[model samples]
Target: MHDPERFGAAGPAAPTAVAAGCTSTPRRLHHHDQQAYVWSRVHVNPSPSGVPGEAAQSLVPPPRSGAASVVVQDKLYVFGGYGGGTGRLDDFYAFDFRTCSWEEVQVLSEEKPGCRENNGVVVLSARDQSIILFGGYNGHRWLNDLWKFDIATQRWICLEESSPDMVNAMVNEEDETNAAGMGMPQQVVNASTTSQRPSCRFGYVSVVYDNKLVLWGGFDGQRWLNDMYVYDFGSSLWSQVQQCGTLPSIRSCPASAAEGKYLYIQGGYDGLERKEDFFVCSLDTYTWTQMPNLGRTPSPRYFHSCVMHSNKLFMYGGYSGSQRLGDMFAYDFETNHWSEVDCSSGDSPGGRSSLIAQVHENNLYIFAGYNGQTVLNDMYKCRLRPIGIPSPSLLNDFRRLINDPETADVCFLVEGREVHAHKAILAARSQYFRAMLFNGHMRESSDNSPVEIRDVSHPVFCKVLEYLYTDTVCDATLEVGIHLMVASELFMLDRLKSICEDLIRGEISTENVINILVASHQHNALGLKEIALDFILQHLSDAKIQGGLTELKSEPDLLIEILKLSSLQPVTPFARRLGNATQHQVLSPGTEQQPSQAQQVRLFNAHPAPQEQQPLWRVDWR
Candidate 1:
């Protein structure tokens, strides 16, 4: 039997929340002990040129939250946001993250862009160069003007059409707080572009991918857009790519990053709901694919920031539906896994959203953001290190088992491939394996020799062994999960079968419902079958709109199964007759009973396979 304590499998033990932000003076010896731990970490707070190393310094720009920040040549430039004294002041300031100092450079340009927050700022040139600033919101209206900042000259220049210059719009920090959605009408001019500029939007997702700035999924004043526009610096033109496959919903404030030839999008808010789904678009195909996360992950959030460094995607703070968050997570592209990050000890930026995180020299420079209530203008640096925080790595151990298995008494050679496993673990996890290995059932081969398994392919059999060791399917896809479900059913491993069932259920739609229903029925997965039927019936309108029911009559097996289930029970007034039409099924509702189609599907009793009919697993291979 698997020992819960030995495997640390009872439940995940939550780790201690690490500290961040600036802090001085050790309050207690306990805190001093934490400080000692901090020094061991890579996080370092460098002092100003003249100040002492341990001194608390001042590096204040204007106190404005929701502003956009960018790093150009080790100098951090912050753009305009909601200023208290002035109504959306347009100002530019720069700070040095390394030295912890601020410099409000003089804007030499005669005209400058107006104030805004969550502006899409990207480094056009990283070699001591310039940054491209795009549309954002002021207190009242969203601005679509684009501006470019020259690091050497310390001036602002309009990259797009000119707007009303706001060079003198500086707030004294002595007036009432400016409300969002206040002020100017920020009129948008028709840009001279091949594909037309993206609509004036805020909370949009933009990132640099394949030498092109890709912008997609943002909210205009009236509606949200799911269109994608790409701006090429070399061509100085914008073109909207015809996005195909499963397009993400119309949303804003979703975090995205570009890696290799793929752009990954994380959580964002759709104005009405916060989404936690993860998706990726391939530059090769430009097709969108949604991938399921492996384990515990961050909750639904928006206004978060994603930065890619060393092929790993790091996530910073954002606002969930209920509150602002100060958590961090890292996603490994190679492993297709998500792991939450825990800092050792230091003052963190705390829970906030709409902030900017720029990675420079293996360190993250986090700038001001709004934490639901307060608009902050603090600068913090998170130095990445191998923080040996405590967490049971059962998956890691299982991975080791795959690479370097041990204590294997019996070997399974299926389809000319070898799979190693321990008899005790298999017996504890699978009943069929238990009966074949430990219940004194003799196979064609002797106990000391390798067993030649049949029927199942190596990939499917590998998933079975994976479940026996790790209780998970390493690489679960729709096809793989279905095959595993079949193997799980044959092996009498109900829990493993349920894992596959749940994964299959998550992807059930009009296109795949019929196939899943067939698998469920064929494998005797009664629960999955009911769930699939209910999904189709519950969301019948969606299936019809998406053309999922177009093939309803084409499948003879599915038709027979539905009719068989209906024929097994007497039709009542609430129960309607399932009429197979050439195009659509019209439920013949009796006058005495008018149940909805969803309710009617639920009324069909799909009894569990009888105990006697369940496979006896009594294989007599001669």
Candidate 2:
């Protein structure tokens, strides 16, 4: 039950006494059970009488069940519920609270536990966010197994016990030795300790209490249980506690609700009789006490659904006798009473039983259940207004990038345009850009006259225009790496410069070394030159010098430039190597000489090196 005051409902004036022989309610209950009972003052039914009846007539099909369900990061996950003719269901679905929609999620493998029903499922209360599923009826057999589904990885892992045989198998796989060769006894001991696990059980209700899982009553074929078990997730161990006071009789399908430190059980059938009596178990004291006089209590029912939302317990459709119910009600634990709610407007699902209900981001989700005869597949959402901050928009732009990679290029294009314009303006104001354009010319041809100039295109000419108009650099290939690197360096964009450097470095194959050296020289980038020289020196050892010389002889001028730059460096290992090579005249002997008229004429007439070399410089970096 919920606190009435929290929902603006008037509460009971005083705490009512329980029936005789009942112990005092635990102190934690006072926080949720202290308000006045105000059932008569509030209207439970908001809709007209005919609304639910009409909605029932328009019932849509529901997804199959015996499936596992859990919520993480405000999204509802429904995985592998029983389907194939009510036997076993391997289908997976997810509900987005923000969109009020449902989507099927695909698993990596087709292998799944056969059709199952009444399985115990609980979301791990850990930061890694996995959901645990335990024993249930898989059509043919009663399953006593444990499996976990990692929401992020979308994979299922079977949890196995640490037996000697299993330990030995793991050890053999990890170690390359036999029993006599086993390294240390403590190694096996440590392995056993880390592998210790919990026994598997299904059809149980598991709720988080003080961050531990408190598991209660579930059928295990041989018998129904009234026993209670606690699982410490941190320690991976299970312990049973001796609880005092009258406990709820052994039953399955009871709606269990948890708020703060107490677990509430209500409205389950005990094979022979349908029950209306409810009980609250305190985690702090390990005791159970009957809740008194739930005024206007829901009819004797089982397989009904109850979920805690904003401290109020909401009860939805379930079976009663031979009939299915569509009515919805709210139980106020604070006032020790129940009231009906009118769900007339918007959308309302028809009567459903064994349906799954979970709360995510203040919204309640009701998933697949049977309405007496038909299994429902449709999904419904109940919206709850938040208390403090306003609802946040679910459409985050950055998340859109991960979900839809195709849109990334378009998004980057738009953003890049703005960034490029800003960078161009900054480049216009700096000396770095001046150095790149030194002794170069950029002429707009009005007439076919060969233009001669030193550093044409003033920074101011394009700077203001690009800054105001947002001009984007469309050609962002390796060809543009040198230009972009120049601009990036001028604008102090180290990240962009690093990206350009990486692109240039990746293009430094032996065939492209001459082009790379020319670009590095044009931009006056010592870093780019160092990268090219190191690559050539590392790969071009004495064994490969014969093949490298053929390519180098064609670019004698470039080789001369490299030798001149190498000579200016202080004596380091690289300088010593370069000096030795220069002294030996590793390049063509006449490269440093003033050529004769015949050789000069041959150089002027030299066909621009192979087309392969020209296009090699234009390869796309990305």
Candidate 3:
């Protein structure tokens, strides 16, 4: 799938080992009849500009075998490796390409489940990125613990072991949801049964395929293995696929790279023999095919590192029998061939094995590994240049113009609504600055014209835009939501306006009814008041509003304000009935009451009843 000879050593050299720090002497190339592939050497130091040093406190030391590594979001993550005195580590570390540094990441609730080496690690692109680690050998006993690491929330979880009862339960669940409504139990039962399952193996080659992890060739204590198995993450189930067609007879330490639907396996030892032969397996067809012999392949090696970059596969230093090599090789997938490149110019490290190599940003990063006698703790970046160019400037007159007060008054309409162009223009310009910093493309100016406005703009809209850019919620009160709503409305941002409206709607839960009422009235957010009134009327009786009315009556100015809001609104019939009941008061018969109807008739002729009848009516009924 990937070219296997993309970064190898090119020129010919009789087998020789240069001392550490000595420049690799470039040997003259033979004039072959075939076209020559010229390679230029550029030596990169072990410690690049951003890479952390071995002595750095944050730098994680390279662990011995039995480690698990994965790449997520351009960062390489290493977890749970064995170190001599440290035993089995449950710690996690991440290497950032941007920072070129290794930082220790604490895996919350980490438990030293077991010490293991040569474990099978496969990164599953499921549930926010997780690495699944299976079966590894501890010092004495072999392990079958299946642990998963979540990248988003740095944590490790061990999967529960599956049993026959669990399998039966799963099968039963599947049967109820079967297609064709067959309601057949035997079909489900037959599918659950499996034979020739891969014995728990360590140091296996595991790769992701069709959302399943396909594992092949590993050691199982007694012998090296070539058995293949597929683990489905969704089902938490393992099934052994038929090992088809002349598999690489039982082997270990094979390098693997997956491209398209085919997995290419190369160079590993088969107990009695060191092999250089390579094979390709079609995951879709479940068939293995041997690749045609490429002239002058890398010497037979095991435990070498292989990484796919830009469809080209790069192989780095590893052990060939007793010798540890620092040579690099690249393979061309189109021609199914290997080519050696000139990597000696860059500050190449000494020969090593058991190293880890990962590709990021078109560069190969090689971490610490064993250099025959001792374990080394150095990191190197191999810079591969497809082409070169000069860096361009990011800042210019246009950026300064947007920030200047003279030009800041320019108004623009993003979605047919007028807004101050300064903030939006500046934000768009900032992205260009970032691109330039990251060595990305320069920003190009657009021809769109700014919207001209005659009125003084609202400062709140500017504040809201500032919050959007910086994520700074200056005012977390209801006012902020109101301001956001106004800005969204003015800018015609329906989504943003909806979000603000939602927040405004949520404010109805506030305990202070008066504040809610005032905010709702000011913002014309009647929806909020409806919710507030619903709560108030349900929990507080007429006594509460009456008390408020009484207090308002004591203060004339406040009463005027209260009366403004108390005007006729759509109240329920029950509330109107309650108001009528509270308004009428019967007077005591003995107490001196208002003038009789006769006196009102003599004074202003307002009464229709006779004087005698009025006095009788006024008498105490009791």
Candidate 4:
């Protein structure tokens, strides 16, 4: 920067600018991809320092409002605010959203100011990392002092001496590329009685745009303000700008969110009534233009939180005339429309006003504020959701429609249990039902009466009906799957048959292979029958040892089929491996059979082979 005239050279009479080894580098920040705000921070030591601002401060911060907070690199820095009953506080705390906890950062040097509210705190990218602070209120009076907290040193440098020098030190300081990043010995200052400096005021609005510190609008005890002030770093002066368009009246505590060159202002009280109007001010032309309400405009309120993300402004939780509100709304600048943000599902900050909300990495971090009854020190994070899904009750409502007698046109008697059902759904799912009902094959179709369903129990019938409505199987088991397979095969429901086949295949083991194979043969289920034979072939030796041979001996036809296959192959040794370990045998206490290795007999058990399962339904007739 070309600030050598204002910052580089200084005489002994001046507040000399000496270079330090501390410099903060600027980072490229984007806000599209944001993760959920899950983690919180915690202070390791809860003992109070017993100092004026430290007394009674535990792990949790003191209840306060009007705190100065800024978000940087997923961490929020909260400075002193007016704690309702506890007086003004000077405690500096940090809440790291990544860690999901808080840690009190005690300033080691005694040069720091006491606690106050409505102060301006912004991140500075000077050679040394520093947080810039401006005016605030400390209960009894207004404060116009400027302070600089050296991040590395953890010391506060009070800048109450000269306004011109402070302005130059802030907007004019150059990045010290030659020195190690730290602090300068001192900064030179010039007197500012020439042009009018900002008056002593609290409840002001401050924002950093293009490295320029802009301060405007505050409650100056005597009157609310509508004037604007901009600080020029190079010129080192505070100049009041003229406005051309319609402007908002004198008001304090309005929400100001910066997006590009425009600052969006929304809702604040004006001594008499709260406001729901919105406005935008251009920093380029210093013009104020009220934004037209095109969306669901919020009720008139004050002390709410507003943040800009993805071309949208989010406003949440504030106080109206009669009561506090927990609702949140989003206004899209491009669409010029408003929509409500549904924070009803997760943990919301809930009806709070006079709190601090900052946007970082697409997530909104809101800090403690006054929630009507008392002050708060809690932090709540909310992830931005882009899509909506059906609620749990919606699924239940669909299931209830099946049992509604007025909606249901057919009935079923399965295992002596009468069940109400919809003919349209049943006919749509099964060919048997469609043929019997729509084709007039059953007499019960004309009468709309319960028809007996043979070989199907009430529970299985209920599960089949549930799948028709929801396409999900609840609490599935082997016994229920076997029954469902039979019922599905009988009704010619291919989808249900496939689901039951998959279920039965998952339960196929040496102990149950025989039963599954016999059931598949009885029901003529080709898929299940194929999978069961493949299981027996892979563990041919184990299949015999597990009683598959005993079942095969009872069926001469099946035995002849196996013998014919064995004749073509000659040796079905299942050469891959058996119950014994083929590699390094680590003998443990128990002797359990190794069932995992007996997958298939690869003629060549190579080191890297394709993991393919053999099919069981490969039958041939000559």
**Candidate 1 or 3, higher TM-score?**
3
Task: Give lDDT tens digits, candidate 4, residues 431-495.
Answer: 78788878878755678568877666778788888877766677888767777777777777778
TM-score of each: 0.49, 0.46, 0.49, 0.53
lDDT of each: 0.63, 0.53, 0.55, 0.64
lDDT of 2 by residue, 41-123 (tens): 11111212254555212212234644567777766777655442434554565655554444556456433333456675677
Residue-by-residue lDDT tens digits, candidate 3, 269-302 = 7767666788889988678888865855888887
Better of 2 and 4 by TM-score: 4
lDDT of 2: 0.53
RMSD of each: 27.7, 29.0, 30.3, 23.8
The runs of at least 3 residues in candidate 2 whose Cα sits more than 4 Å from the true structure, single-residue gaps closed, are 1-62, 84-86, 106-114, 161-202, 384-622
Q: After the best TM-score superposition of candidate 2, give how far the Cα of residue 296 lies from its true spot, in angstroms.
A: 1.2
Ranking by lDDT: 4, 1, 3, 2
Best candidate, lDDT:
4
As a TM-score, model 4 comes out at 0.53
Work out how many backbone clashes candidate 3 has: 24
Q: Candidate 1 — which residues are off by over 4 angstroms?
A: 1-57, 84-89, 162-195, 387-622
List the candidate 3 regions with Cα displacement exceeding 4 Å: 1-57, 62-66, 82-89, 110-113, 160-197, 388-622
RMSD of 4: 23.8
